[model samples]
Target: MPKGVVRKALEGFQPYVPGEQPPDGEGWIKLNTNESPLPPSPKVIAAIKEAATDALRLYPSPTAAPAREAIARKFQLDPTRVTVGNGGDELIELCFRAFAGAGDTVAFPTPTYPLFEPLCRLHEAAPSRHPTEAFAELPPSLGPDPSPLKFIVNPNSPTGALFEARDVEAAVAASSGVVAIDEAYVDFAPRSAVDLLNTHDNVLLLRTFSKSYGLAGMRIGFALGSPDLIEALDAVKDSYNVDRLAIVAAAVAIGDDQHHRKVVDEVVKNRTELADALERRGFEVVPSAANFVFVRPPKPAAEVVAALRERKVLVRHYDREPIAGWIRVTVGTREQHEKLLGALKEIL
Candidate 1:
């Protein structure tokens, strides 16, 4: 074999492993991915269809004006402090590129969205993983080096455990690093750390249309921060990071608050029912403020996952620290939850 040319940084990079999507399946219940079971608001669908024309020949707006305006209005933030991305994931990678670099360190809680560590490595930043205590608390210190950027997931992925706003406030106040609060699931949660933005210049809040708005395929997400930080991200991002269709879709989705609330309420209902059932089945279910439940079943989580897969039901199985034996299941439709619980009973 010929010797291949690759950067030294590429040698040990471990990429994020998102949940799988099987190609061929019938009657399969997909609960592994945390996507909304609901469809995009009818208005959003109409907007996308309306935009489908010869206009695609032209490049999307370099600024994504309409979408940014909608996001600003919906979130009540200044448009100058907002920047959209291909998705929330891209915003995260952009943060590493803009802030943390060689010799710099990035710290985030363990059992989080796994992309943060590899993103740090790809940017040549020394990424540090701090294991959350039994109750899922950020560690006391920043370790050997001060992290220039700190990422935290509110209603954290997989574990679905929400950090209290007070605790988050204290952590952000204590840290010298820029605190990036990833509120990907905040629509389901009762509160947000975004309120801290008024007082903390170092805080950045990220939002996505993929979950509550049911636009995952649209690949639209936005970041809110101080103008200086927003400018840094904008300088680092491509001239046009968001596309035309996504911008249109996201704007329409944000405008229809009524539909958004209806879907979220349904998901919240299902989430509660699913969590309660799991608890009744002898599982230790975490109190989730997100649209999913992290449950430690009496049976081995891996085995339960495997059995559920065999029965055509899919849920996430984690092998990471602090939550190794737990499973993270997205709250599907009411019918989907009933089907899942029925299968889980057979497996258990």
Candidate 2:
């Protein structure tokens, strides 16, 4: 190692590990990543093709204007209050970069998205763990923290549980710093904290086209908040954060409400069915508002995951806090779920 080669920030930083993608044709069932099993809408594909001409030679719009416009129209927010990113992950990173700095504390509920902690660390900020014991349900013990920045994921990850809106509101109202509410899975849920936008200038609402819009490949997401907050994010974001094809495809995806509705409805339906199936199989399944079911299987999560893998099925396994014994299974097609259930039955 060279002297003075690295910043102190690099010492404790850990990168986020998204759920895995199986190697080509190696697995018959893949449910690890919480990605939609459906393909992107045909409209999105057409837009991508249309934008894929000689335009590839030119740089994409730095601000991703059209996508922001479509997102604003879809969500009934002002265009100026909206900003697009490569993915919801980018927005999370940008939040850290924009408001948080070395030695500042970034607080978030434990066992939520793993990325939040990693991002805080990467930014050389102090990462404080505020734990949620019962599927990320804010306990009576949790209230405002002294941290200058907080990240809360509604319908939190891995555990597949929704944080109550009132709990979030209280946290926002009492906290002193920027409150970022990550609603990446909110489209699958009944309501959003967007209504709180007017009441709290410190709040930033994050949404993604990855899950519900089936645009994970295009990698687009956006944030809504006060115009000033949006401007702050714009100041730090990459000049061409989003590519041309992604901008057009994401816009069409946001504009096509019919397609979004259909996909969400199907995901909700399958989520219920899969949860029920797991319950019937003697697993304790958490009630999920997101597109995945988190369950405590009869066997250890690692054992069950390994068994499923042997049967050509893949589900996420985590060795982390708050849900170490559980597995998060994404809602796939009916046939896919059946295959998963069959494999579990055989393993049991």
- Candidate lDDT values, in order: 0.86, 0.87
* Candidate 2 accuracy as TM-score: 0.96
User: Model 2 lDDT vs. the true structure?
Assistant: 0.87
lDDT of 1 by residue, 1-348 (tens): 123565876775677777877774577888988889899999999999999989999999887889988888977888988889999998998888888899898988776887887787778888777777754565555333368899889978877888877778887888787888999999999888888889998889988999998988899999999989888988898888898999999889989999999989999988988998889999999889888888898998889999999988899998776678988899999888888989988988
User: For model 2, how big is the CA root-mean-square deviation?
Assistant: 1.9
RMSD of 1: 2.0
Worst 10 residues of 2 by lDDT: 1-10
Task: Please name the candidate that would achieve the greatest TM-score relative to the true structure.
Answer: 2
Residue-wise lDDT of candidate 2 within 225-310, one digit each (tens)?
A: 99988998999999999999999988899888888889999999999999999999999988898989989998888888999988
Error of 1 at 323 (Å): 1.9
lDDT of 2 at 252: 94
